[model samples]
Target: MEQELKAHLKKLMASGDVAGIIALKSERGMAKPYLFADASELECLCLTPKYPMASVARLLLDEDGAARFAIVCRGCDERALRELAKRHQVDLDRLVIVGIPCDEEMARECACPEPFPSVVAVGTKLEQWEAEDIGAAYRAMELDEKLAFWKHQLEKCNKCYGCRNACPMCFCKDCELENALWVKHGRLPPEFPIYHMIRAFHLAGKCIACGECQRACPSDIPLMVLNTLLREDMEELFGYVSGTGADAENPLYTKEEMQ
Candidate 1:
């Protein structure tokens, strides 16, 4: 896939299909976004330790077509970009996607249901990861046991907002978490279940299950498992999938859409 990716980069660069490729460049010991124009730099492109590459591209591209580029997208990145575009965060027409499908190992590591983007330019698109509903097991326990289990997990939260920070879909100029009235600032744990419930309800049909929140958590919380369940609930309720299309109805607009 590396060789194929390099070849595609070269082709894109030579044909002036993009201004530059927004991809991960290994620097020192970190893999972060860098504009890769020269095909030689594709050798240093790192696939592991994924960042929200789509967000990087969103910030780089202009809203009025002032800049154009091709991005190296995984399934999550591609889906996130689609979602962002729907929200007017990015201009999709000005960008091209050079998709790199995750192999089995990376797919399993991310625990992603859709490991491959719609555009399969390079690499083999492995089957979706079969994720376990860890929440379901907790739900099956007795009421008291379930309460205790959630209390224990919720107690560990330091109110860092790492989950919101890592989430690509969480783009709001004014967030409820930041409001002193809703969340009461300067309080750790932030009222436990309500604190977490606010985020859970907000992300129901919006989260793409990228696992970025879990990665960013210092406390090693399995936030993605909770998000997966939310996604499932949304699908069951409204029959919608996040980032599937620009015109796709979101659960947030359910009332308006039903009119």
Candidate 2:
């Protein structure tokens, strides 16, 4: 699969369809985002350690508005790019997405709901994985139980901000999490659920369930539990699924007629 993807990317670069191809390159046993400007660099290209390539693509595009680039994207990466485009963070017109479908094992590991991109340039597409509702037990608890649960989990947070840094959707220059009014600086745990609740509300209709937050959290504070619950509520109340497409109207941002 890696070879096939590398060949496809080499073709894209050779065809001059893009200025460069943004994908992961294996170096020192670590996979990091690298731009393949020359076909020779394709030899080092890899497809593991799913970094948030969407964010890297956005950064490159922002640096050079006229430069066109091709991105190696999984289902979540494509969705993240679509959402970013909708928010004016990226221009899809300047992007040529090289879609790579995730296998069943990768899908199950990530607990991915939709594991295949719209177009499969390489790798076989798998059926949507029905990720178990990890928040089931938490949801079943009473209000007090839920409160205690979060309190215990949140107390372990050391304010590393890894979750924010890893999130593809968190592109704000000035994050509310750092605002002294909400989360005081130099305070451990950031005054309990205040810090997390603020972030949860901010991502109410925007989190794409990429699981980067949970993966980045050092405290292992089931961040996805809160995010997944909010995602469900957003769908149930507004019929809006984040990162599904760029054209879908977000109900939270849409104006309603006054009755």
Q: For candidate 2, give the lDDT of residue 225.
A: 86
Candidate 1 Cα deviation (angstroms), residue 201: 1.3
Q: Which stretches of model 1 miss by more than 4 angstroms?
A: 62-65, 127-129, 254-259
Clashing pairs in 1: none
TM-score of every candidate: 0.90, 0.96
Q: Tens digits of per-residue lDDT for model 2 on 1-259? A: 9999888888888899899999999999998899889999899999988788899998999999698999999998998999899899999999999999888887777777688789989988875467777778887999998898889999999999999999999999999999999899999877988999998988988888888999999999899889989989888887889988668866778897422
Best model number under lDDT: 2
In model 2, which range of ten residues has the least summed lDDT?
A: 250-259
lDDT of 2 at 27: 99
lDDT of 1 by residue, 100-174 (tens): 887777677777878889989997786546754555775568989867867888888888989898888888878
- The lDDT for every candidate, in the order shown, is 0.81, 0.88
lDDT for 31 (candidate 2): 89
Assess candidate 1 and give its lDDT: 0.81
